[model samples]
Target chain A: MKKLKRSARLVEMTQYLLSRPHTLIPLTTFADRYGAAKSSISEDLVIIKEVFEDEGMGELQTHAGAAGGVKFIPKMPKDQALIFAEELCRQLQQKDRVLPGGYLYMSDLLGQPSLMNEAGKIFATAFADQEIDVVMTVETKGIPLAYATGAQLNLPVVLVRRDHQVTEGSAVSINYVSGSHKSIHTMSLSRRALKEKSKVLIVDDFMKAGGTIQGMVDLLAEFDAEVAGVGVLVESGEVESEERLLRDYVSLATLAGVDSKSKEINVKPGNYFSK
Target chain B: MKKLKRSARLVEMTQYLLSRPHTLIPLTTFADRYGAAKSSISEDLVIIKEVFEDEGMGELQTHAGAAGGVKFIPKMPKDQALIFAEELCRQLQQKDRVLPGGYLYMSDLLGQPSLMNEAGKIFATAFADQEIDVVMTVETKGIPLAYATGAQLNLPVVLVRRDHQVTEGSAVSINYVSGSHKSIHTMSLSRRALKEKSKVLIVDDFMKAGGTIQGMVDLLAEFDAEVAGVGVLVESGEVESEERLLRDYVSLATLAGVDSKSKEINVKPGNYFSK
Candidate 1:
């Protein structure tokens, strides 16, 4: 590579660092790539770091040593996150979101990549300081949000399947009662998917009585993995505190109510703002 | 909010443009954000565009006139894409990945965010000029790949559920034969999930006889939608040409053979390289 002007070097370096979140890149890398001095690279990073902090994009941490480098920890500021969550609440409050059985249609919101990316950033921000080894989620609806969070945290996602499949090979299955329907359902995870003693962060699209998440917890026990944290996009406010299966978790929005008769729905920002 | 140095502006602008792919951003928007003249913004864009092109990051498209703006189109050059595909072939050829029924365990590979991001860029590049409205895939394994592709294309993703869920109100259900199992399975998509006449790009993790992809195509016909394109990570070479259901598609790698007894797996680059 040839030498580049400071402006071009800054642009390229920013792009490189943004794509690789949570990974350390030695100063020599930029210095060599742009055919510039290490001191010049350090100066460029100082400028990028200030803009990132001023814009609430994330924090760039620097390590000083032979193996030291800079790592970008992606984060969304509380004010910006609140604004996004409030917007989600507005979108969820639409009357048309109400289905026949008091269910809310959220597939459209989950389908939007930009929206998921933001929501993922919020979850990543919530659990940024934890020592998480992997991001876990069930099949289908929760997969996108899980992947979004995983991308930001630079973690692998292990999916628990609803039903056992031949492709998954040997698996450990568990039965947990579904809180909404009061019916027992089975969920399984492949033995090879998660390692023992792994710290897993669980994320989902929605939670009602926390039955599905509880099932995941039980399944994780079989693998000897620890539940590092739990994050959901929405949680039902109708469930009594006593009836809720989990005591500790995070949610971006809370579904207050859904009236099947009048086709009315209520939604608000979750406990994420209360912190 | 305030005017920034040229170097800082270049860094911030690069980050902003990279995040919002496929969306038009007017020169005035940048000018106002940085409190800079439109001419300075244009000059900054020229620098960013040159770096982007030199690094094979993507293309910065400029639209001229009153309603015009700049749009970022993400692309992965063929040489880099082939390198990634070959790396995938090596990973897939691991003997331990062979399962009881000769099915390779790919959930681990699909669990990787960085790997999926690159594959998504390759697919996005392949169909960059196509008139795509949404990226569609089946439940479970294909969800992440679909979302990855959707993120790069700046399109929403629609998932086809294997079993009808109450949450998906008034879905259109269709049964198709599973080519590998020779058994019939039903898949459904919510009526509200997709709009009529949508041009959809289908993606999946693997293809064997193209039964699942065929099912998605058949289901799309119910909505009067057109299949703009189809992409799979790995295609099964064991399936004879006569046994395959679909003709036009793209794949990153091909599974040549999987021996259950010897636990030997053969994987090669897909037709993507031949083009």
Candidate 2:
């Protein structure tokens, strides 16, 4: 059989793996395709896997079962998830984060990849173990995180716009008093966004008053889909009422209170990975 | 004709604008359709505009031009983008962020809504002035930021999954060496993910060697798509590479270096939100 050296072989292996997210491909097939021995292919896989593993690149899951082979989990460990959350929280505490209304200045972080990546990990871990069919977030603020968690899990993310669209054609919208705003807000998901009985994980950037959160909760009820978990970038513990109904929440930062002046911000550890 | 109170009014307004991202809509339309007076519609639009604008909920663009009225830009200011990038950078600096072999721990922030929302804003700012037809990210890590940025611009995110599944009828693939490991990796995009001349922005969670980024870049060439910009969650600066040519980049943290033993890690900010 023709043989290729380390560099050439490694590229072929990764390219093959990259094309497939989580499905397992046996060693025998790879060996034949690469025109290398099974042992050689095995060795190459080890080298490639180790390099990627060290770099937090997508994973290579090897199964020993008769039908088992190598599969990529595309995952990051739990510890990795927490370190990221804590780091973002620290940055959020800086004096410059003080917005005009005492809100944490988060524009930079939101536009950044490091913080976004870490946040993705936290939510991914939150839903990592859950058998989720789709990742859902209300339109606007929640779309980015929802898409990230969905990517990590190899699931499709559906955006629930606050209003219906011509493309959606039909939708189910519910009016609920925002947990934070105390004023009513409408939350909606298109008829095509989801299917019945989907195990969903709901995520958003912030939960102030949670009118949107509860609105999503109510929207989920409309579809009869199970809420697998609820996660947010930041959670306001100050919001009154409706706290008991939440299950499986992960917040990177908890705003105890943004001082009246907005200059002094108090933050506590969030529910993310704290459990 | 008939009218709704503030809460109901805001929800309805938010829903309408979100459905038509990057498209212009006249205020008179909302006024006439809601059966409310133009003055009442103006008040509602003002409130809708303020909430999304103040909170970075979304961009509200009001064009007084003869051809325009009120259009949501789906964007926020640059200063806000910088704040988020800095916040994420500070967060990634924690000691606990250390992983095996001097690697930094990540993945949490990438998936978080808070961070992703910030990341999305940054990209929206970059492309806010550009006309992007679609947002593209290779499957897995880049998905969240890609989706978030896409939503902010009101564009549909297209994923370039590894394999050609039944759902993805056909695809184009490319091969490139991963910057991190010097291993060749194949990257792919579904044939239907985008169209020719589609303005694409490539986003990912991390950029160690940028091999994956390069692969995706090369992959886009296969589809005849133009890359408007390239964005990443985190980038490693200290590391040398033989990766593809890159035009633009946004990352939370850029690794400075590691101690001789790969301990005592150091990181500097990437070009994210550099005014």
Q: Could you say which candidate leads in DockQ?
A: 1
Tens-digit per-residue lDDT, A175-216, candidate 2: 877543357767677665678998988888877765677677
Note the DockQ of each predicted structure.
0.89, 0.03
- Per-residue CA lDDT of model 2 for B208-228, tens digit only, reads 766777777787778788788
Best by lDDT: 1
Candidate models: Cα lDDT each: 0.94, 0.66
**Top candidate when judged by TM-score against the true structure:** 1
Candidate 2: regions farther than 4 A off = A1-3, A15-20, A51-59, A240-245, B1-275
Estimate the TM-score for candidate 1.
0.99
User: Model 1, range B93-122, lDDT digits (tens) per residue?
Assistant: 999899987899999999998889899999
Candidate 1 residue pairs that clash: none
